[model samples]
Target: MKSIDVLLAVLANGWVVSAVLWKDSISRNTTDILRKRYRDEKTQKFSTVFNSRKPSLTSNPASKPFYITLPLDHFTTSNTDTFQSRYYVQDSYYQPGGPVIFHDIGESSIERYAPGLVDEEEFTVSMAKRFNGLLILFEHRFYGESAPLTEVSRALGDASKEGLTAFFKYLTIEQALEDVVVFANNFTYDFQSYPSQKLTPEYTPWVYVGVSYSGARGAWLAKRNPGLFKATLASSAPVELKVDFWEYFVAIEANLAASGNTNCSADLAAAAAWLSQAWETQNETLVDKLIDTVYQADWENYISQFRNQDDPRIWDTRRDYMQDAAWTAFADFQYYGVQGGTLGKFCDIMETAYSDNAPAEGLFATESLDRAVAGYTKAVAAINPYSYSRSARNKAKLKQKRQSSKLDSSLDDYAWLWQVCSEFGAFQVANTSRPQNMLPSFINVAAQIDQCIGTFGESDQVSLAGPNVSPINQKYLGWNIELSNTLWTNGEFDPWRALSIDSTTEDAPTNDTSTTEIPQCGTTFPRGTQLRYVIVDGYHGSEFSEDVVENADDIGLNPTNTIGGISASRRVTLTSTGTGTPVADARNAQSLWFNAMSTWLPCGTQVFTFTSPQPSSSTPFKTRSSYSTDGPSTDGSTTEGLTTDGSTTSNPSRQSSSPSENKTQSAASLVLPPLMNLFMLSLFAFLTGVGFIL
Candidate 1:
């Protein structure tokens, strides 16, 4: 049954695009999932309906891209003084007195795709409309077209080299944060001198939004400069960076176990044990022999089959860097969980193949195992988010030099790897002590350290296992750091969630002032920084994706995808109520996010509304749903309605009191159309047909 679900999801969704883009893959930032996924599925064309509502800033008449001059070395005045940094502004929602939302682009290329926070009519845009706020998207310093160095002659060498090392020094997260600040200062209030004269030149409240790595930046921005950002909405931000991230596998195993697939878990564990034993032997020949024998294929050929590049093994040691590819495949499935348990599907296959009484043609069979391994390898290889290949890095560099580039996206993979090697040691290594360990011991902390040494030279200050890691922890406040008005969220199943702060974590910065204890998922932590764990079944960044209703086939989702541990903040599809209110189904993440947004920026009417009529009050107040209100149903649907003030409205209010004298009853409620019911029903049917029933 699990295998069937997996097949259906893969067939329906084509591939886990976001998982391939941002999740654990070979070379984390190598692929740009957004571009590749869209190319395969939606082609280069975006949703025309969506494009009409929130056009790209570059395409909009009221919007334009701007390049601001920034210091190459922000700290040293003697160094090269300036480099051009890129940013975009959309003034369609700008109101002289309104707020602004600053969207932080992640480590990927932003200009390659159109930008909008929430979908066509979702929460972010809805809030923009409600507050009449301006929306701005800023590309990080080294990503997209924001290139400090136009060309690089060398791929690997000393820091004094005029290529990678010289350019990478300016690509720090702190510099990127400053780039946004400079852009904000120039655009937000410097109106007379700025490109957009239509916008006001006054201080306005600003909100920050980011996902994954950028999400952590947003929180850090709010933390370090609280007055700059009014509030931040961060989804799946691993603010705490750890060097030896064995907990990554721990999360994977726990999530797999949550699926209730005992046999699947057992088989996968057996495979892990076998692989670990091979690594423990420390014999390259023995390891290669075991791999070829078990899977009935040569390790080098199978690993290189996808990328078409030679094996990633270092010439100095026979250790195959591509050995992590199989583990990555399993890890991605657990992290993605797109159609509810992608990992479960892989496990089911393993269980079948490793069964004691398996047939001759099964995975254990010499001939069949070879075929199965090769097929799986090919599928895993196709998971790239970026258009170019690792083999094309040099080609891209040479091409950049030959052309007048508006935006050099070739720096993405190189820049991201530099960040990981320099600061954030988020290496996904194995913890063999765990009972459910699935990754080989060779993919250990030392291997990753060696990788950094190979990429960034031996003299590089990147030894987290050695004496150099303490400064990074001290500078970032490690896991114990605290900040106010920032929400830190992580998916319960996300392998990266292990690095994030949670209830059981004891590494929180000692300087944290908040008294709130981080709670397990589905609970509230009101004392300190806002922390949310999406425990109700989701993969990495699932909360950040737009919550729109689509056909099961379109999204590779089935009705059964909602089955998992229940949490207060879980999203589930509810049965339609025949009424055309378009409020039957709602996303718990969106609901919670909007609710938090209202609290942070409370100057306007709440973004959404849902409430029961006052108990026969003498002053009859009009009961009208707000523009963003999509109330939960009383018929036991999964949708949770929002109150007038952005509070979760699950059950209708039973408060017994007279209506407030200040409240005005809506005229629409007082004089209803004769065919109101029919009109609503028709509207609902129309919305359902057009896939807008969120």
Candidate 2:
């Protein structure tokens, strides 16, 4: 019995020891797997991770990719002897092992608070996916999270009035460019602390992308740091240094006209004309009614179309309108038939128009409208060249025609009555006889009203009026010359900026007579600048359709095959054949573009190509071809083609002596599987371990 008991105890002890050893082994193995996936280093410190220098180019492939966001110190100068600036850092993210990095800047504060609008975050994600690169989003100083510490400086004394403007003047393009460089340099090193991977700065190239205001910044950055960034994708950016308020007004008018509201346009124009005549005659009662009618009608017919009051679009439009109006009104209120107490009365009317139906009949009823008006007025007054009265007079003459006619009599008369009451109370304070003090404000307001009415008051009018004076021409000059050397982008449809319409030709416009040109792949501009233009089917930056959004991975990973379509092999075959003539070649310029871009961009080689017959041309010219990386190509094609007839040739065959030999050595000819394999391995491991966990 004693011997048997001993044997049982020995077996139990051995099992216990084995279990303890097995648990420890499993724990270590799990930790090892995680470590391999993350590339984590147990001993690395946080500070060392954050501020590490860029990795050397030849790091191991198994290393985990680094990712980070940090602040960068940027500087800007002031007009005064004092150097006033702030420390602003761009928010950046770096994907491990990806060849490209992206940088984005935020919009102005006015753009952000506007009510019915979509933010840029969704768009940014979409673009990041499309480009398959790291994204860096930067905040403009004096806006959003980047407000300057000098707010107190503005609050000290009367200088506060000009403080914000002065501060903004210091936040110039040059300083913004410096911030981009610093961010790029730091992005390489910040990834060092990750346990599973190694990131060396030398392995990845950077691509800068911007939208709206940031688009301009992206373009300028690309120009400034050609070595740092491989390419730039700028969307809806307005980079012109000088902008006219009239352009915005005109855009609104054109938009209204395009909506096919003939009756509304006519009525609005008539009402404006009546007001102008009334102001000239000093018909205070008539003028007051006219002003009220104008506000209500404009809001109902035009402004309401922007968005619901709660909508971001509505908020943005209202904010813009108020800002523009206040600047124009305060600069010269009399131009809008406002004087003396009229300014205060106008504020009251504006408040009522914007406010909800409430018990106390709130003064400036709409808090949003009131705040917008006040803020805009303050901003405009600070920057305005002329004083109030002077601006008003200039506005009255220009807008007289538009203010005269009333649209809906009931709404017009009701608004007119309200205006009369306000004016009656305000007219008592009118010191119209004392023109000197009031004239400046009046003139400024008038100039703004004139701007709204599609007329230029004396102070607001340009002395030299011609093609040179046109806003489009002016913007082009600034973009092509002063702002060109910097990385920047201008939009084709943006009211404040203009892109070249002459994209078909290579020659940049010399004078007013020259046509503006679009940029394409293989299209080189003077001074080694390359231009690329993308034409989307819908409104600018339209989201992908539901089908596309749902099937992105399938489309990206395994595209469907079509027998008659252009494929990788077919494209190669076309290049190999070398049968098309120069004109036939000129017509196939788009195909050549696909071929060229495939050579230049690492991402481009992965894109699938489809060729459709050109609709505008006969025989061989009749076929139009289009290429897309995202999915199957849309069937129809537009008339845009690559041309050699201009300053440059579109046909690679004509441009190069030995086309067949060149095609063989072209970047497109290289096998894509090796790079794709690396991408897949990294992607699979990343998706499995990271939150994707698929």
Candidate 3:
């Protein structure tokens, strides 16, 4: 495979953009972007299953897939044209009038992983079980089995001028958001050929939750359509659309230097400086020890073919860049952490090698130099364990290309690369002026722009310019997102945190300066909808992980507080600094989020009030068991004499025999039209009335 292909494969395999730069060094625990399969503790693989919604009478029911038909173009004259998009549902814990949690699938394949979101020990599942709610996962358009085009050949076969343009015309972030709104509305009330869900008296409440890129979508979706989506839990979401995102590397280096080893960081920095000097001096022996000269020669030869082409995608450089490997190592350490299988051991080797050599007169003695070289080799091996295997694969692919005369293509890579080029240009480049800069100076924004253009093989067709990202920033308000009823939670160690809405920064103001207070480490702003931020001491997707409550010996902070873990890391809480609200405890985010959901959509309370009289044939519906005159009571129970308007009322003249029978009568009392379907039909009708129909 070409170097570009390898980079794109890494992008497709995970949601984090850094994954493309440091593939084998990082784990797949971040976001489920381009992953093929995931394995649990038992080694049980969760792979994608490609089956239609309906199986014939002889086929198994478990293999069935669900689909939603959406318009080809929702905003234009061709909006009447539609395509079937796939989705998955897990309703085992679904209650008739409980809350609904929708997990947004990012820019990758969504299959059996859909069910696992609610079936496993994830927080979504726990929330579902807590509220007896329904869970649904929808596939993004052009990803997984939800292809807009019928044939793979038509979608990704041709990369030539016209072919690339035609392939990505309809695949925009706006269209995907529209698709989500359509899915959310439709899934709440009806499913074709399955039991139709009743949305009556107490309409089920909906909550949107997502991590990483999807996390950004979740916040925006709720912000865009507030009434439809009641609340949002956008974990580790990057709200800003950046161009030269050098701050990302700044955060990465900070995290690495703080990785429990001060000496290791110093040695790594020294080594990077040394490599740069060697590259400039053209020290053959030193350069060969650092980078493979043969590989560099091959790269130069391959890249030279397209240099003179007037295409912006083709790079013009001929120099062999060093320290990219070191940058990758530092990135892996910051992203995955030492516990998540990163380069701590390799850093140890480096530290040992550095101490033994000591760099006398800016050069090492023969024995110590060999030891340091050996250490460097071990470290590179850890970073790119499959280096040999990858070379073999590339050679085989080249031979196959020579015979068949075709390049290996992937629509997944193309799709994501387009998004990066068009919207979030968060290209991680080195900020060399900073004191702690470790990445090589050549790995800058210009290089990333070239890569973006090169990957798509388009100059004018794709924008490496500013026009594409400006409108989005203007529309969404960038990091100063003014959406209410939205929550932003991020892990302290997540490098993407630099680009997100961090309350502590001068860039992300709370608008109320006196009230805006940044917490030390494990604290959150008082729980209100006025754009609050919480920074937890965890890795990516930490807020969404299940919190395990376990007894522990007090480590001197709070003896009775006990301890909890979100996977390997300990869970911490955010203190409530605002007046009248007490400090939160026990899985701070989970507790705060759970309380917010209950406040947003309480079970024992009626959200909507009705004035029309019930039909004569309608049975007496049972009232909720508990109610609070002031609001939600401390105890999770219902009271008698509760009315729709949240006021106390006398008992009904007639009452059902039991709660179960009353529930049945309540479900039967009033009829509800499928609002989502009706809305879609009305949309078409309005378009026809306006003479915009095809």
Candidate 4:
């Protein structure tokens, strides 16, 4: 995807100005964007990547898919049936008994990681090949092609709330983790060799790496199944769970202010305040007008085209339309960071609303608050507003999209929301107690309750309880979390940091300056000195996309690719001190991980390439590419033996085939998957040309 920074100035009197040379990447971006689905297709085409015991590959092995039968219900036999979970293996680098590096792809398609398998620049591939490690992309159940239950889970025309009930029952944190454990127990990889290596963690050193929801899964799975994985690197994992997470907007507001654009945030607050005032008063005409202005002149018809049916909520959208409108610009910032175009573009629109006449004073100054409302509207018009909802229409669209086959979606909404509704109560609410809330005050626990009832058949009451998020915490000690040989990481600007070990920590985090404090991998017993990292000026999924361009001017490039290439080439700047920048820390984290992996397992170079690789400047990609018709199956074979039982096995001694002297290697390297319905509008962004999709 092509990207060029534009800096055109806008004057008052409601007019326009000239700008920079524009390059049309939308066609190319769309082409590149659409091609991403090939990863899944290619993955399924070559069902088994492992050809033979003596097979050899001079070049890096392309990632290929394998399916293993996992119990649909790990907890009980009520649904004793089984479903196939997909995993991709890139084992060309795997030497005899070398460590296994598992990059968890939770709530994402296998296609999203197609590059990580072969691209040496990616830490997953580079480090794995260096250490002669077997790199495996482990797909979490119910996401991407790993989705189970053809008829009701997601894209088989039966994804209604009633239809998805059975499927949702199988999509649980424990069940997903158990899938990993069972895979481990049954792992029969002839890892780059003859006899079945039975590459169980007992026989090999397995490293767990994941970001966002996968990050949380990595942490929780590590805890549940100890021996399955030796070292864990959970980036942007939200360990804490809660309802009414008003603090989410706190990060956005702080980030906007920190970016030296206090007025942008102020304007945002003003817009929210304006809309909230109208919403509170129930001014139908103004509300409708405000929404129409934000959407389009033909907003009603525009919305109706893609709608599943004649949704009653279109005009009187349930779950606080005002709140949804205010959050439209910001729904993705948490996932893509401050640089995600929508949020920044929204701010720009808000600023230019009256900036020409009265530099900083306009909206909220006038009697009507027209400028504030207009700014909000124009911003959404310029940039796609994240108006994803679990309303019946979206459900019908997902259920029936198979008819057109334009796109097939993972039941991300249903699966993730199930966890949130049942146990993980992380409702994105507003902190209304504050004098000026960046997010509209319309969002609160009650609003979330309406959402829960509206989506699932649950009428969970509004409880402004402690971000106690205790249900999962009680099962696993929330921030009071600890694991053996684990590396915990979070992005500084990641909104989910509020729930990760980064924000809710029982122990002080690992100081960046004092990384050496992390003990040598094997010396410590039951557990090692765990490492906690905070990516300076980083956002969700920072580690996964470390290749993004970084410099004195650009500290971060909000990648839309990770979330499906929708956000666009929004950029952020920070004074870079060669030592602690986003890219720098990302690499540093990788360095630390490599060192720890070496200490824990037998591998090629005791150290690895610290030489910097060329950075990638692709447009922001937000989620996975489109899914193929072939998702995780109820009938499939398993070479990976992918499971997460975590049960211990007799230790098998392993030796590094290409062992080398321990040398010091230089450091390098979701964010959590946001629990928002915002991702649902990615298609809208792609087709509308309002925002860059790829």
What's the true lDDT of residue 215 in model 1? 78
What is the C-alpha lDDT profile of model 3 across 223-299, one tens digit per residue?
56555555677777877766545565454455555656555455555556555555445444654544443234433
Judging by lDDT against the true structure, name the best candidate: 4
Whole-model alpha-carbon lDDT for candidate 2: 0.27
Give the per-residue Cα lDDT of candidate 3 at 589.
Answer: 57
C-alpha RMSD between model 3 and the true structure: 19.6
Candidate number of the best TM-score: 4
- Looking at model 2, report the run of 10 residues with the lowest lDDT sum: 651-660
Query: Candidate 1 regions off by >4 Å?
Result: 1-64, 115-127, 153-163, 188-202, 279-318, 321-324, 338-342, 354-409, 463-469, 503-535, 548-586, 602-694
Q: Which wins on TM-score, candidate 2 or candidate 4?
A: 4
TM-score of candidate 2 versus the correct structure, residues matched by position: 0.39
Q: lDDT of each structure?
A: 0.44, 0.27, 0.46, 0.49
Model 2 CA deviation exceeding 4 Å by range = 1-95, 99-103, 109-121, 130-132, 151-169, 188-203, 243-245, 249-258, 278-282, 290-694
After superposition, the stretches of candidate 3 with alpha carbons farther than 4 Å from their true spots are 1-62, 79-81, 150-158, 188-195, 199-202, 271-285, 293-324, 330-335, 354-374, 386-409, 457-461, 503-506, 510-535, 545-586, 603-694
Runs in model 4 with CA error above 4 Å?
1-63, 77-79, 154-160, 190-195, 302-315, 318-324, 356-358, 366-368, 385-410, 459-469, 504-516, 525-529, 548-583, 602-694
Q: What is the per-residue lDDT of model 4 for residues 285-354, given as tens digits with 9 covering 90 to 100?
A: 5666765665443345434443343444333342133544565566445434454324665666666775
Q: Per-residue error at 71 for model 3, in Å?
A: 2.3
Could you give the C-alpha RMSD of every candidate to the true structure, in order shown?
20.8, 29.8, 19.6, 17.6
Winner of 1 and 2 under lDDT:
1
Query: Poorest 10 consecutive residues of model 4 by lDDT?
Result: 13-22
Q: How many residue pairs clash in each candidate?
A: 10, 97, 8, 41
